[model samples]
Target chain A: MSNKKSSKVGGLNWAKLGTVAAEPATRACYDPTGVAITLEAKDEKASGGEGIVYTVPGKPGFLVKVYKRETLENPSKANAIRERIEAMCENRACQAMKGLAWPLMPVYGDASRKNLIGFAMRACKGMPFSSLFNGPASVKEKFPAWNRRQLAQTAVNFVKRVRLLAESNVLVNDFNPANFWVDEQCNVSFIDVDSFQIADRRGRPLVTHTYFASHTAPELLASPSALNRPRTVEHVAFSAALVAFQLLMCGYHPYSYQGVPDGGGCGSPDENLRAGRCPLGIGADCRLPDCWYKLWSQLTGKLKNAFITTFRNGHSAPAMRTPLGDLEFALNGLLITMAKDADPDRVSLNPCKVKSHEWIQTPAAPRSFMPRPAYPSRGFMRTPGFARPPYVPQQQYNPQGYGRFPTPRMGGTTSNFNPNLY
Target chain B: MNNNTNNNINNTLGNLDVMNPAPRCPVTILLDVSGSMSGQPISELNAAVAQFVRETQADEAASMSVELEIITFGSTADVVQPFTSMASVTPPAPFVAGGMTLMGAALSLAERDLAARRELYRAQGVSSYRPWIVLMTDGRPGDNWEPVAKRLRAEAERGKFMYIGVEIGNSADHATMCQILPTEPGPVKLQGLRFKQFFRWLSDSLKSVSASAVSDQDNIAYPSVASWADLA
Candidate 1:
């Protein structure tokens, strides 16, 4: 393919066009009410795989997300997006929700009003939700005073928004972490609202083909055809639970675990989900990292039970998944429990007994602690103090061969993490 | 007290260190800083590297997961930056082009570094996505590279990592790159020195890969390289 043609196939070229300093260009467009609105696209705010968000010169409270040229060029995709955005704009209940960046109006590209380009929504202010899942050091840098309580509250706020969307008959099919932004108050404002699966006036799905595999339920992952069809609240339950788990556990996927010798092969998150190999589930026989184990142990019994049930039983029985309301209740109770404890604002729910520096230094020390071999003469020195022992190719890839540590037993008694009957 | 209660207390006391863990995605960039790339080429390459870092850091998902390292080949392969998470990585010192291309040694270093990094991840019980090895060169290698090329080709075939080869400017030995990546699409030739566009595409691609679940990772359609590559 020619360079020009191939480049145009995707959406906007953010590199060539520049992200923050796009030249001001005036575009003639119309709003949802058929009012002709002239948008003086000022500065490029953000650009993603699908579209570019631009700030409007006169519109102080809103930003415009212009669909890539390729998206509008495709007749079917353009129509579907236009229909979904229009439906969302018309949904009073959806717009009433304070946290969603709901489409206020569809911006047509031309005077005919038939050409759909993008939509305008309220500009959201906050760091991406993904930032909350970073390492403790990074978390401290981004949100200095945030504690487990704040993290719990963030999860609660996210669940509430998801619940509100469900009530309004909208499903956030794509649960990408970058799509949600959380402010200092733990309020989550969801962007990419146009991609949400919406229901028509007749209660039919305006289906969307977008889902993150890590966030998707097992049933959906097993069936490729189901992705194109309308998703149910059951699917939402699984995703919501996964998000809540990650938020509370500092980004560790519930399915992510170290493989025991007798355990089924080590697999990726989706693979583990497909195999129903949750470390917290019964008969899973896997081990979580030391830190993750501590975090899991720190959760209150009720909250832990909720997660255990949702991941273990809900894997097979979709109906057994914890409801959003129940999760919210559990989280609020957790807050109450925290408030009763000393140092409620402490960074960790269960702070390490070790000194702060020692706790921070342990995980990374293992690599440096390993005995180093004498370096062979090479032309130049490797990056200072970062030299590695010579690489020897393994005959067979074995995850077990790496420095394996004993899986910490939840209560030091049982090997399994299965909670006793509640 | 019951055994379970005693065990719980013991376990808690035994493992007192708290760690915040996330899955990792490591990417090693091998760049040619041969004498032929001394002037504007080196300057543009430096700028592009910085831009790539800035762009990758901007995306929260990529910033959290993507671990970046850089290896520059001139007199000999030099580790400009060791593998570090994007959240903490700063742009490296400006590359000064000086000597013959040591692409073979550089490739070897990248391979070794990646293997070591993966071992570390496994030892730490950290789940990692498929690692990426990107090689960008503007001149032919001065040393023997046939053995390293064969090994890289085999590794790529084994799906150990994603290998991307970029031929920079007119002097790049595209045929040699083609041999190294025989099974995969041949090396892409850069359109002039549009390093910014190339790196941006790379940033976007990494973001997509890191954000995707394992089931859909192979199916991820990278953004068209047409913006910076000469496909024709």
Candidate 2:
């Protein structure tokens, strides 16, 4: 019998379809194209530090982000969002944003819908990027069929998105795990559209303040006015590499190590990241499973060189960072190699299988015990100049040497076959 | 004999080479199941603890790293469940309250258990985050709690672990609690039976802690206490 106890907790209760739904709050959103979009609220389950996310009743794949009453109180911030919406509406859709949750239109509370407070965008439909590192259970629950291979594919998708964004003259100022969602298919969507760095009407950067400490470039973090500085493509590449490391390495952060610092070495992950302490290079004290080390050893020299340059050799200099395209090429090659090794029928066969007998078989003739090159002694061997003395006839030629010394009386059990030869 | 000796040496070295310990975070829950908590409180506490376990088990990051234990204080303090992975923990059954609260003994046991687990982690060469101690009560301590309180204060001061004290209802002795718990944001008086919300916050905090490089204590971003409790 198990000693475990079952505790009673309330189970999830979803409203039945037959139940009447509550009257939803409705608003009309306008685009610069002179088209108006009506949005009816359904239910809100996701509340972030900035605003509450409500599902649109009519749109199955879209959601509306309404800024909290407090966030709109600041006029400058509100006007910046308004200008961003106008720009997005005027510009042609970028191809890189195919799988992203880009903003669609401006939303307002009043009937005129002229004052912009929130915007409508494609809703994120999967687990947050944090779930990748969360553990096997969470990954199993959220992305049932996803494995490390799938995770790497998701990371590759992220790299592709960043590359496209760069081509479109846009920058993801804040590229942390929390701002992205991934599905089981390795598809990715970027959230928090307001944080993207884009040009306003005056061609000035619309937003700043995206240096998340863990993923931020060391140079950016060291800058005195990091909040005001515009993020560069190098910064985006740095963050992307960090995410790639997690995806490929089962959620281990690039800087996580297992030893105490010596004099000037880094003592923590953040410190190690800032100090360029990569376990594959300067941070040799970091420990990983033997299999991971083996996998890393098999990587192409070019890929390994790129990792070293990005994380260890050129970590401090933003200009030395590997471009997203280069990283994608290396990762693609790695995935191919891993896939080849993952073939189910690839079994390694051992060549040796010789089972020894329980007892040794010695030679029939007594004189055969003498050591010879072709027949080495099976058990203990005597040293040179330490051979045993030979036996002589005990009886003085009494026809049969006293019948071989009367075949000495012994126990009933005796084997004629030698017991010391294979 | 030579082959046998070589085999023994190889076996020992292989064990060492294969040792790959994962980082763990130990959490000790010291609960008060006194006579005052017989009715709605015990049920709610049980439900909340169950929710905490379920949620932690669901979070892959927390499940892999977080270890949970439960120490209940009723007439006598006893560890209902020893330290185990959050993914494998059995939630506590609702207790029928009976005697005086042995909060001191429970805290003492919690401290010892947490210390022993930390040592075990060290012996296994597993890096670990600082542990967490959660004390919840609806009444005053039946035994003297000053000594254990001092030990806990020292532990918290050294950043050895995170300590949080919770008062269930109006019957709690706030004055004694303030003295017994860590003073840097001491005991919190729960707003009704918001145990689920409080545990949800705890689960989120631990999930974040497990996911990050949590060597610096200041890096922890606590979910706001205003959502569930107020400072005593």
Candidate 3:
């Protein structure tokens, strides 16, 4: 394998410390322009999925993505939806400048016809909210204490920004944690801007809702309504899920909340794990199963009336959920109440907990660990060090092969992901 | 029976005439993780995986339908991944580049995997083309590949599997690896660490397979794409 052109032809190979004549790790490069690229490996935060996170060579701290050279075969569907997103980014940047909305997405680049590649400012430097909130031993063990009042105010700030963007004709993904970045000052920035939309500027969504499957509201999943259906249902759900999760941190963790039934297999659970503190357990998967739907109905059985009759409960009518403006206001109000020298985390809220057998399985670690991005676990050039779990055997129904490794896009259920549809 | 229900669903998805459920190309990456392939080879192999992931992520057709699995032969020939969707497929666990290229065990693994995966397709009611197998290796098999090669040829002749051998590094003996496939366009060398490029060609070839309405041998496109242009 000593086919070296130079030591630093690309960037650092974590597997080998010195200048090794290693083969090119990736092959699907389509820079027909032959742009002189110099890949500089950045000191990435050691938490999230695996893969080599690189700042585009010439672009100067611009893009971060895993290349196609690895063995995992992921359909680059993002490239297709990205074209429309670039226009949205321009719209949002304009909005940010106009004081209409905050600019979260940055740029979109296409390499001729092969694939779409782009980058956003690393959304959050702190940690994935999922890891921080849920005590997943696979991720960080604890979240530092922040005053309830301060945290509530921060939540409101993000809500206000989201609401303003929604009013401007944008539908921020409520269920995707990978898209939301919680900064040092507690500022929330949304990445994956390709799916963003301009308020009232009409045409089908640049990014389809089916693509954002896991975070999909039961309403959208069950009914293929108007394209705008997801925007409405998801916006309200996002606000509630956020507030609900925040509530749990303060010790008054509600007993339960009403649940939404998903369309069968809407394929966006990574975001749920990345954004919503969702467990990657089988039941929590984006795929819809009759049993889990039944489980959900059982958990929130008492709140059936509120869910079906009242809009206050998001599960009420298929279309009715909390309004973005109301979410902004409630979060703001929650902030103010906590700011009154009282504990923000102490706010009272009713929980229609939908207890599931899945939650019972939580204390067990899911198959795969990437205390970092999904690609790097394979990229670290370390030994292929993993043994089958003593408890789980490999088979057709329960294949033990590659079950725990993050291979990035394998054949997933399309409750949300469809390369052509997206 | 449950099989009947599954067959109906399969028929609905791949409505091609022959209605073969097995993939037109059942590619197997016979990875050599023997002691001689330690450190760089093992790491390079992982990088190859990362590259393959990125390529397929862009391949629309293959990503949706192409079934993939990995079998590694070091001290033992282990089936790391069975035929699964690219969307859900996980990367094989990292290997320390230990043991011997138990080529025989690996081939046996591929033979069984192909037989079973094809059965799944038939039951699913999906239409598919003649299957293909890709054998990528870095060295001569410590376990003789002659019997496995003969068995692989039999499957190819029966319109079940197509085999291609790729030789990488000095540890690889092209003449020996070549015998594993049909005596057509001999085995290809992984020039200048081109594992990623070879996979690109492989995925692209599979994409063509997925897009085709027919599952016949003639319908599948391969040994053509620029990535595969190096085939000699």
Candidate 4:
């Protein structure tokens, strides 16, 4: 039991512990075409489980994603990744796409251009697509004054990009919303383009190892080798439809309802899809949040049918999923309708309505279908099973203010607070 | 529809509130605010907790899935904040530390609330990931904690929820903390006063958990805690 408060222990300074302070020794690197470039490690822009992204010092419009050392530990895997990126850079169609942060050049670990550590890509600017698919309050807070027309336009933009990728014989196997960014003007930019399954000029997939269960088709989820196989256009359609649906319906996952045939405890969204239970499907006895039901009802009949056909009929049959072109047309029609609306109040993707009962008539007790809990008021604490005593302010307490308290000084002692730890 | 019916619908819509429909991942934090944690410790803890909320809210997927609740035990255990969606959660008022360490009563209250929340999820057909209960304390328990600890350990063994014990400082009773936690991944001591780093790690872990596919839940690898924790 060491009661010593010293941040240093056994000649080790804990303040600098785990910090990657040592810069990479090799600064000069060559592109795939043997062009020499210098990389200055100023600061990391972002880091994730796979790699760290940094700005190319002289290249203002480009970002360099350096693979984490562990991610490229296997020689064979590293070769495969390099080859895939090289093929992508060489592809004319992939290079021509303006929406994607496509790999521009393969970056090497040294001047020999033998060790492919990462690649440089165009930098994308915008908030994550997931930000658009948030709760009403968050959406309103992030994009103030954004209406249904904007939502529809965002979906349309996403559809157009997906269609272009499909035309280029590429498949965005992973449909994670974080990988896509949407600007205020409803323009979408796709990131992580390196993870896409691209076909070579000979029509063979250069890279394929992706199956995100949440957005993947049920048939793919059932296959153990789904990751090794290239995703089809139909499969991509399902994912695209799901993303568009989330954007349009204000983040309601198509499979997020309760009360299916066997008491609705099917766990994850993937599991729900595997069980072929969907709230939008015909004869679905499930209970959705009232707002979801309202949003579903607010959608035009054709669009509703499209979603139903995709999530329900398309669950087992991939071909039944709505095509990206059809989805784009339907969204365009929606935007047109919104433009012709007489009242601005009704021009919201998330319509305010209380007619869920008319849509879903569950046999369960009506009380069970009540709206979800509201946000708790500020300063209202819920002390379960005990009466909260009246506030008796302690010493140095500020009742009227709520912010970071000024750091108090230690009398005749050195404090170990490091502001730059993160 | 008639004009009256349309007006009624409009009124209902006006009153109706929308919620994120993603699967729920409830995390309840049990903080010890005994007299021992008076000055710098409490301040660090407050700042760390506030940082954790901000980090979680910034993540799109985590904000939709994670529900946070906080329980503080001092003279008496009280739910300072109920289960709240990260999207809607406001940073709680700075906690004022004082009084005794009623660790047992707080654990009991946390267990009861978790069970109630699970029941609500089941009844509403809302799917949920494994819930998490984080018990953080600096001093020894002032009340009988053995019974609740035993039950909680048994529940943890049953895989109902994950119970993580964090020892705040050198004054924390490590032996008792170890006993309260499960066998594997036992109690970890906080490094110096790196509560901010610890909470950042926690926020990142919760984000991964919330984003994980159902099949990958068991294999979710948490980020390294060397920056914040002393496993030794």
Q: Give a tens-digit lDDT track for model 2, residues A1-422.
A: 00011111111011111132322366455543545666555466455545667777667878777776556667877776677776765545641355576777767755466677677777776777866554333455666666556765787788778766655556777766767788777888888766777765566665566445667777766655865776666677778888776665545566654344453222445666766665653224455334434334444334554565566534665555566677777677656755886432111111022112112121122222232221111122234477533322111111222333223232232463211111
Pairs clashing within candidate 1? A411-B7
Could you tell me every candidate's TM-score relative to the true structure? 0.79, 0.71, 0.39, 0.79
Better of 1 and 2 by DockQ: 1
RMSD of 4: 19.7
The lDDT of each candidate is 0.69, 0.61, 0.43, 0.70
lDDT of 4 at A363: 20
Q: Scored by Cα lDDT, where does model 2 land?
A: 0.61
Off by over 4 Å in 2: A1-42, A112-114, A124-127, A135-149, A201-203, A262-268, A282-295, A339-422, B1-26, B55-66, B116-131, B157-160, B191-197, B200-232
lDDT of 3 by residue, A1-422 (tens): 22122112112111232222322433233232534334443433221121234455455534444322221234445543444434544563443432222333423233453444432333224433333222111121233334334345545555666655554456555344444545445665554443454332444444444333333443444444644443542444444444433322321111111122242111122222223323212222222122223222231111221122112223223223334444444455445534463322133221133222211111223223222211111121223356422222111111233353222343444454321110
Candidate 4 matches the true fold with a TM-score of 0.79
Model 4's chain A TM-score stands at 0.74
Off by over 4 Å in 4: A1-29, A33-42, A260-266, A340-346, A354-422, B1-18, B58-64, B87-90, B122-127, B211-215
Compose the digit string of candidate 1's lDDT tens values, residues B1-232. 1111111211211111125455678898989888999999999999999999999998877887888888888887777777778877899999999989888888777767777777666655666787888899988888877787788778776777777788888888767877876345446788999999999989998888777776676766566665787766
Q: Is the docking of candidate 2 incorrect, acceptable, medium or high quality?
A: incorrect
The deviation in Å at residue A163 for candidate 2 is 1.3
Q: Rank all candidate structures by their TM-score, best first, as comma-separated numbers.
A: 1, 4, 2, 3
